[model samples]
Target chain A: MKKTKYRSQSGNAFLVAVSAVILGLIGGAVLMAAIGSNPFMGFYYLFRGGLMNIERIGNTLATATTLMLVGLSVAFAFKTGLFNIGASGQMLIGGLCATLVAHKVFLPRPLFLVVLVASALIGGALWGVIPGFLKARFNVHEVVATIMMNWIAYWSIYYFVPAYLKGPSLETESASIAISQSLRAPWLTKLFNGSYINYGFFIAIVCVIIIRFVLDKTTLGFGLKAVGSNRWCAEYAGIKVNRNVVISMMIAGGLAGLAGLTFYTGYSRNMQIGVMPAQGFDGIAVALLGASNPLGVLFSSLFFGILQSGKGFMNAMTSVPPEIADSIIAVIIYFTATSVLFQRFWDRIARRRGSRRADQREEE
Target chain B: MWSTLSSIFPYAIAYTIPLLITALGGLYSERSGVTNLGLEGLMLVGYFACAITIRLLQDTMAHSVWLLTLGLVASVVAGALFSLLHAFASINLQADQVISGTAINMLAGALTVYLARLISGSGNVRIRMGIIRKNIPFLSKIPIIGPLFFTQTYWTTWVVLAIWALSWLLLYKTSFGLRLRACGEHPSAVASAGVNVHRMRYFGVVMSGALAGLGGGVILITYSGEFHGTVAGLGFLSIAALIFGQWKPLGILGATFFFGSATTIANVSQVIPSLSVVPPVIFKIFPYVATLAALVLFSKKSAAPKASGQPF
Candidate 1:
């Protein structure tokens, strides 16, 4: 009976997530219709723009690659019941470190890759470790600390990039890293007209798989999950909860840093400072919407990528500004975050139905 | 030395206006247990709303000061209304508070840019006649202190300080203050005593919206005296100030002034002959570095409300 009830609860959770997405899409369509565009055409364009052409597919995949890394970053923290809001700051620092290594150091491609990756990991891990340490030792709320750190990271990078690495001449951007190139896979390079369908996508996929493996198969993962479910219980079970929290944060920060590298080295080629993209915060929504599952994040990140790529076509085809996509995403997240409420509501109905069936059976 | 001190005073006050107001806004929400990350978004909307309203009513309002006042009121109303979206999602619908706040931030950012373009018929809009300075004759006539305190300070600075004092009184001295604190510290206990948790949270969020709006208004009318896409990040700085202030109204005010002074010093050091030896960016980084240091030092000892992030 307990197992059956648990299965029903899982079923209810799935139903809630599906319904929320459908409701969000319907609301978006209604908004498009009100804006004087045909909803059908808008959706058609959305799919076509995101997937119909090779270049578009490549762009979608490229965008998804960074989002996947960020989603993993946020999910890793969430698994340990920590909200790593500093992912944005960590990503910025990592990007800065990667750029400095690539631009300031001269080495063979293989050695450079190792150095850049190490710098990115160390930079991001240091940033994440601050909040982890604070939360572990001082009981400081990670949310407020991480949020403040983001601003510090942003302005510090803004100051440093212009002062030290502005190519000794330029006004707004740092020098492009030496040997920076797109990470396109061989088959994708031919399939996508030389678009940046790079090795980073594969990296993102591997990272996701590794994260899932660690969470499901490893003792460290068990400790993290146990701590996330209940700190006191995990501690009573002989888990070093504080260490797990810090390790989880370090892993999360490393993933976000990799995201920055994927963007700079695999796509943009320049370390653009001043404004880190909103990928870190957006990862929160992606993680939640994906239910914090690594595989779920892959699909959700792809969905977000589709929305981003489709926005351009949306602007071209209608009077709607591309920003309408952001509104749609906000609405979806707003609903997705409230999915527990929906699950409860559905479970009550299901229970009522089950009870009535049992009553009928007893009467017979 | 006197001249340098006097020159820096008005600039410090001017910079403090937005941060002071927004920190007070954050205090309202946080004191009632809702952690308003949407303060920045609310401020952005207020900034755009004030700019567009001022642009439209500049002729009929005749005086820039009145127009500024009108813009402030409009922004406050708009901010309160905009924050209702967050309050509804987090308080009523039981969504994740952090994600709801972030959603509001993204919406505010995209909406501000979209609205600015729609209103100005372009991507950017600038005020024609910025806020005009006004002085009280008697207050402007004192000795060395007068120039620093009264002569050059904008009316918004005084208003901000007055609001800060008012918030302190309301939060610490009144029955409403007791109830609000009770709600934040233990909503279930407050509910058991027959007080409404949802209503207090709503009130808190709405108040945050209004104050943040005023903060945005001050930035537009008094400091930058214009509206742009880049203005969105100042609200985040205000959040840092709130935390650095340790979530107290008076502390927030002091932190605001500290940050304001830091910013002014950074800007002024670039102009000083002796200090010009240092790169301007170092000065630019000073406030953020201070924020980081303050967070490291003070946050460990600060006692946040018990129910601060919980959605109850």
Candidate 2:
């Protein structure tokens, strides 16, 4: 009976997620039709673009790597009942740190990689911790604080890149890092037919496993979840709610930092000024769809990665703009935000099913 | 320094008007117990709608003034309609207002760009003409105040300030305003008093959408002649101003103007010899940094609406 109850509960969540995705796709279709584009053809090219060749698959995975980390970052915060909307700012700071390390540091390859990754983690954590600290100490809203942090990072990059890291021709971007210094693994590149796949994919997988284990098996995880469910109750039960909030934001920021590292050094091998990585906000959709679970984030990130990686091809093949992918993602998030509508629909179905089962038992 | 001050004053006011109107919109929403974090998105929707309306009518219209007036109306309508999505989710659907607002922001950013790309094929809509800045004849002749406030000002600036004044009176001096504020402070009590909490919140949210949309339209007419799919974070900046102002009408006026001055100074510092000694980044980041500082200082005794962010 307990197992059935758990199954049904999971089933309800799954249904909600699926419905949101369906509605979002329909919304995208309507948009496409309104613009006089063939919706079916657009979607076809979009999926094929992400999966047509081994190289494309590798690119998709490479894209998913950054998204996965960002998703985990958002999901981790969700677990502690905190919203880390400053992931973009955290990513910028982390990427800046990683870029610095890539340019200036010259240790042995393995040692260099360790330092590179750690720099991003620390950078992201520092950025994340400021808002966390503000929220904990001063009761400031993290949402507004994070928004401010995003702009600060944006303007800082606007000046810092031109002053310190200007590339050969463009003043808008940093100098590219050499492949050896980047997250590129020769073996993986060769395996994927010279695609952009890098060591960040492995890092994402490891993070997923570690996060899963921590959330399910550790006392710290229990305390965090307790605080998330009910902070007042958790405080009464001897949990340090403020400390948990800070720690949660820190870990979340660190994860987002890794995302930045993977994106800047591994996928692109450079950073561009004036671009707020949309992946940060896309991560919110991933976490929401994943139901804020580690495993759920992994799969959802991969799904979004396909859409993101495929969009350019769709635009090339059809009159549809590449922003269709983003529009769809946004629609999906809106539906997810209004999931209470889905909950009612699912509840009504469950009630009917339970009543039918009761009738069957009476007949028996 | 004095010459620079007068030279910079008009631009400062131009920058402040958009933020002031948008932040005022935020004030209404928050005071009515809904945290409309999607003000940025709503502004974008207005910005886009105005751009499209003006773009379509520019060739057909004889007078630019009438064309611009119609464009602003389109923006207000589009903004109010778009905000209904946020209102429905946050109010009727009982969704988390912050998440819903975030969704609104993302949707506006993505959807506007998508539609713009389809319409213009380049994702940017450029207008042939913008609102001409002119001196208020008699007012411009008033020694110090004239040159600083009345000269070279966009007509939209005065319109927005007029709206601000009217909003202040409506929010402070009316029974309806009292009820709206009451809903934010104690919705249950307001409900018990026979006020429709949901209806009042909807009105507040819609008002925010209209004003924020007008703010976006003002930005396009006054300084930006192109719709390039972004307000460059002005919507978010206005939100910070809303907070800095502690959700008050007069306070928002001051806060937005402060941010506006900082922004104008940052923008023009490259050309101004006296200010060029200071790094442009410091000026650019000043408003955001000050907002964070303001939040920290005021959080101890925050005047945020009591029922704000809570779904009715």
- Give the best candidate by TM-score: 2
| Cα error, candidate 2, residue A93 (Å) | 0.3
Q: Model 1, B199-262: lDDT tens per residue?
A: 9999999999999988887888887877886563678778778877878887888888888887
What CAPRI-style quality would you assign to candidate 1?
A: acceptable
What's candidate 1's DockQ score? 0.43
Give the number of the best model, judged by lDDT: 2
Clashing residue pairs for model 1 = A183-A198, A183-A199, A184-A198
**What TM-score does chain B of candidate 2 reach?**
0.98
- lDDT string, candidate 2, B1-312, tens digits: 889999999999999999999999999899998888898899999899999999999999947569999999999999899989988998899787877888898999999999899789899998888898899989999999999999999989889999999999999999999999998888999999999999999999999999999988888877999999988888899998998888899999999999999889889998998988989899778888998898888876778888888876
The reply for model 1, stretches above 4 Å from the true place, is A1-11, A30-35, A167-170, A178-190, A352-364, B59-65, B120-122, B230-232, B277-301
**Residue A167 deviation, candidate 1, in Å?**
4.3
Q: Model 2's DockQ?
A: 0.57
What TM-score against the true chain A does chain A of each candidate get?
0.90, 0.95
Q: Rate the local accuracy (lDDT) of all candidates.
A: 0.78, 0.90
Error of 2 at B231 (Å): 1.0
Checking candidate 2 for backbone clashes, the offending pairs are: none
TM-score of the second chain in each model?
Answer: 0.94, 0.98
